[model samples]
Target: MTDPDPFRVIFVCTGNICRSPMAEVVLRALAVQRGLASRVLSRSAGTGDWHLGERADERTLDCLTRRGYDGSAHRARQFSAASFAENDLIVALDRTHERILKAWARSDDDKGKVTLLRAFDPHASSMDVPDPYYAGPPMFDSVLAMIETATRGLFSQLEPAVRAPRTTLRALRRPDQEDLP
Candidate 1:
């Protein structure tokens, strides 16, 4: 099979302190659980730079910790055009983030990559994943739940593309084995 191309995904929100950071950790953990860590590169960012150098909110960290996710190393960062170029999918936590990303998008292709995170979930017909930063701990839990569900759906959509390259590589190797005989 041919070498697999890394599938890059960036989760975004208003400030990296809360939702985005949580999404990043959750998605990373999910990828690891599915044995897709080496096949995918998941990260997070914010539309604003308010917490650029700060760690995730204490409440968010605590919530994630309770769920067995480590958020100790999460440092907030802002999304950039460079990130858009690097990621295959740029998932926004809400419509506001989607707008910000769309505005910053350099081309039609870039805009196409930007989408609401909830849209990935077949159950989230509402299209918005409410921001939980201001609403406190319970809100964080709700956001986490939605993100977990969406990530599961996202993985389902991505599985085929992720495996295609590996399949091609195996096909190529089979021919090489025949020549060795």
Candidate 2:
């Protein structure tokens, strides 16, 4: 577990308005379905800030709404060095996002906390969730399907760790200090 708790997670992508926000809503919905909603706090941001303060892409909203997931309130934002401390897990939607996030990690432990979203998928074909912005409506649908499958797997992976009991808070071990455990 990391400070502020083990269940906080952030989804990452190239831009917040597309894949990452979609992922956030999908995972949040899954958390609710799995009875982990109150225990798991899900969020999202992007590697770039170009769309900051903007709503999620309309295509994404349509796909989520039509699929019974709520994504109406998302606003774009950029992932930053500060995010490393705020989230226990940083889930990158693609390999590129993972690399960008790793560059912000202050220590090896922070780097370790960052993982590709599809890594949770037991039978994933590709690790990257393709950006749907440039493509047509069908691509947005494809993104939704991919996010849904990955988030389900992610929820299962984290659920046990989240449900486990915890001791009193202790400051997270620094990179060098982790070897002592």
lDDT of each: 0.80, 0.82
- Model 1's TM-score against the true structure: 0.86
- Number of clashes recorded per candidate: 3, 0
Q: Give the poorly placed runs of model 1, Cα more than 4 Å off.
A: 1-3, 166-181
Instruction: Please report the candidate that would top TM-score against the real structure.
Output: 2
Worst 10 residues of 1 by lDDT: 168-177
What digit string (tens of lDDT, one per residue) describes model 2 on residues 60-158? 999888899888899999998889988888999999988888888899989988888887676789989999899988999988888888888877766
CA-RMSD of model 2: 4.9
For each candidate, what TM-score against the reference? 0.86, 0.87
lDDT of 1 by residue, 1-181 (tens): 5447768889999988888888889878877887878887888999888889899999899889988999999998899879978888898888988998999998988887887777777777677888777788888888888888887777776665665664442211111124233
Best by lDDT: 2
Give candidate 2's error at residue 2 in angstroms. Answer: 18
